[model samples]
Target chain A: MKTEEMITRLAEGLRPVRRMPSPPVMLALWTLLAASVIGLAALVFGTREGLDRPMTRFDMMHSLAALLTALLAGLAAFELALPDRDRRWAWLPLPAIGLWLGTMGVGCVGELVRLGAEGIRFHVSWPCLQFIIGLGLPMAGLMLWLTRHAAWIRPGPVAGFGALSAAAFASIGLTLVHPTFGPLMVLAWHGVAVLAVTGLAALFGPRLAWRVPA
Target chain B: MSHAQPLCLMLAPGQVARDARDLRWSTLMAAAQEGDGAAYATLLAECLPFLRAICRARLRDAAEAEDAVQDALLTLHRVRHTYDPARPFRPWVAAIAERRALDRLRRRGRQVARETLLDDAAELGAEGEAEERLAACQLREAVGELPQAQRTALQLTKIEQLSLQEASARSGMSIGALKVATHRALHSLRRRLTGGAP
Candidate 1:
């Protein structure tokens, strides 16, 4: 009859959806989104005619973008399934982002070799490199920033490594392919990350040491 | 003005109440097991008003009362596994509301205060306090539709509060006959009351 009583009735389902989140998860997703958008841009360049000469370079960049989108959205969805306290384990994504970004240097060297041998004397041209930097290093930096919340976190080997593996793979395959992902696919991918990150919170977030027990 | 006024019931009126009356708690429990949100919502809606009143009377303030209700409902779902189907549902619910209210006060580390001594038993008025303002009109209107014996038996048992033996003795009927009359009276009353809408 009263408003509070009404709220309590409605709250049964809403209780589990409280927006508790993890640190590593935030980094992982941020890295993924930043990289995905950049990857999408490179995809635009590859599709456009002006950037036709160094095609493989753009293709590889495109592939990395798709991968980041998949990984970030997946992380988001997966983490969301975890319990409330465990939601913050999302911070684990930060270090994983770092580990992932570190791998990009390796991929870029190979691309740099491919570009140099072609005798193409292009100026340090903007969109191409900026796109690559956006996907590759900036994502890593964003992930690292996300993980800065780690001081309050309890050590969790499984989540930490899982997030790291996700980020590392996101970074390792940075220059791997130039596949085209539709916007819907990108959204679904983003959905999955949001779901994972939030799901992980729903499932395991409650156990995170930083979560004040309800 | 009379038609526009809210029903002043513990539950939502008309279709919602009818829907709830049609509800079978057993069905809800089954649907909830399969993760049905709608069924769960219905179940929660049905019990909430009574649970709210109990909580409000038992606890110190509005916030604490609602919080205790939430905790109790969670516990209800948690322990739904243990609810025995054969027993009446109310006492079990009342026991849970009582326990959760007590638990909430204890958690707050405050002494449980009471405006009235018997918290759960508080009433809008003492029993029969409003009897004069409304009485025989309702009973006669509803009971008029019953068979003569059934109507007489019901009046003796309910309004007169006579025991079955006393009712039978007073009415010059066998005990078995009196029981049958009461059952038929209730069936007739239910049909008349509920059938009017449909």
Candidate 2:
């Protein structure tokens, strides 16, 4: 069919679609759902060593950092999903992400000082990795579904941010249950899981999300 | 005598004119998204020429470019809901059109490759008299494996080179029946020869 004819047909058959909620609103909804899912998972699976210690300042600070990262990254992903939006909007989440990494760095340094050079060991916690990733899966699924309507001009970055958002939130849940290992171990394993999710999402997002009929 | 045209004409003036016109497209799109059918039609109509121009610039073949334009229109229709009113319209539409054209280009590339392979196979098939005889013998064996009625019909019509009426009379079957049997026999033999089935 000719382009003009097809356009006419499309316009004639047009139906009003409900306008999508703004990115922030959608991000808020996703954050609420992600928190609930992660909470439920933590309740069911049990934390690494059990929550015997009362909420400490470090714990609260790290959790807040994680929450901020997730929220900011989710907002970035939402903006990136749209076509023709200013690409600069992607940098909005960077400060939060940097702060989160900085906080992790501080914690690592503190641990190193406490343990002394000879005592420091890079421990790999298999259970911790499994828990963060497990919690991330549902969150990632929800985020993908929420953003499926996006124009997806930048699928790789959008998918990466979406996965990072999910993994960041999942890390918060992991911190609640998992025993504190050295900062390096947390960084290594959690970083690996987050990268894995980001890589997979980038690879598969164009195929699975934002499917335009052939 | 007519005045001689300049050899180098600047495109900036025409581009500026087009850009001015395209500025209203976002307004039309926003209105259309609110269920204004006439506005939607106008928006789509306005997009048609621009889309065609983009496709033509990217594609060498006119027919392929037209096909790409249609595909882009279809995709734009499907994804219209994704358009944000606050954003400019041209980039969104252009992105969709460019992606669709790229997809068409890739599919055409693959199709050209497959056609090349088929041409090579045809060349191989035309090798020599010995190979031709061998192929004919294999085809005959494949046809002989068909049901008795189909085999008889194929033999009388194809191998004996008889007319449809003659084959029907010789096989003691109606013409339509003979035609159906011959078609089935040929289909079965082709499948077998092509290694698709026994």
Candidate 3:
């Protein structure tokens, strides 16, 4: 082909793809997500072991678990709806950070309410590890997931930025539980998770092409 | 290879005679990369006639001639990143342009097959005779520059030998809507030829 004509065709011939999902679909997804969180919260709050005994500390710990579960479920479902973006951003840090923050906030609040007169005590024991798993994991996972090894958004970079963004958001939740865990642990965990999530996001986020025309 | 050659194997008499600007391989590439519209215009203007001749000699339709060139250009821009800075540009561009033109021809044939299936109509597969093909090229030489879409629709369906359905699919035109594209190509071809012949 003539180079000029060929060039002209390229400039002139291209057409935009237009098959993006509608707003109603987005609203529906959001609504379903909200309902799931509420339902799980109710389920956690409603179950009182022997009807009046008010349940043990271990059993009453369902509130944090339920919140984490709801966040996970909602993110997983929404990830599936994003086309071409596919499975890339679906995994790791995004929902994990949010869930972790939520878990910490709810768990600390519930613990305080339960042990009113005595208040809650901190120990670096196995349950302390449980505290980490329920609260710490989300923040840590989110941070690591967001930041890449090099921490840049250059093309072909594999780190997902959204995960980092999630971690940053989740920090608020983590700080809420700081009274039970000290400033040192909160700062440490929050620091690691935020850096990780942000780095990953910088590396991988731009590849999403969220608004590709068909 | 250290040297670059125009590999079309079929250049016509006046095809190279007209639209002769920035004919040297390096100059055109530099112009194109630098976003000089005039240089681009010259580069395309020089190449269109020969490319059209190839389309005409093969396809037997004025419309397809323009499309072959248009598609080739679009392919050129899309894959521009692949061009080697150290090499002569013509050969690289020619290879892409030729492949794109052939692809358009094939896609056009596919579309015709599909449209025929839908209507239970016999598809127009241009059969026999050298004169018809040459005439088609002559017609294309005159009026190949209209809208890119129209050029593409015509080239794929006619010269490249795609059926309407297949052409429609690649072009993102519905089977029902392709007739408009066909009309536009032919009408422009007629107007250009009446005023002056290429």
Best by lDDT: 2
Q: What is the TM-score of chain B alone in each candidate?
A: 0.41, 0.56, 0.46
Return the TM-score for chain B, candidate 3: 0.46
Better of 1 and 3 by lDDT: 1
DockQ of each: 0.02, 0.21, 0.04
Give me the iRMSD of candidate 3, please.
11.5
TM-score (C-alpha) between model 2 and the true structure:
0.68
lDDT of candidate 3 over A112-214, digit per residue (tens)? 6777636645334332233333433343333333221111112222223334333433443332222224323343454455555545444544433211211
Write candidate 1's Cα lDDT for B3-114 as tens digits.
1113223354565754444346656644555556566677677777767777777676889898677766755554443334343354445556666677677766643344
Give model 3's DockQ, 2 decimals: 0.04
Native RMSD of candidate 3 (Å): 18.6
Sort by lDDT, best first: 2, 1, 3
Kindly report which residue pairs in candidate 2 clash with one another.
none
Model 1 misplacement above 4 A:
A1-44, A47-73, A81-85, A88-95, A104-214, B1-38, B41-198
- Where model 3 places Cα greater than 4 Å from the true spot, the runs are A1-214, B1-23, B115-198
- Compared with the true structure, what per-residue lDDT tens digits does model 3 show for residues B100-194? 55656677799898866644432344443345556668676744676777777787787656667546645666666677887778787887767
Superposition error at B157 for model 1 (Å):
53
> For residues A91-207, what per-residue lDDT tens digits would candidate 2 score against the true structure?
987888787778778877887888887787777788877877777766776677777755335667787789889989989888877776757787788778777776777677656
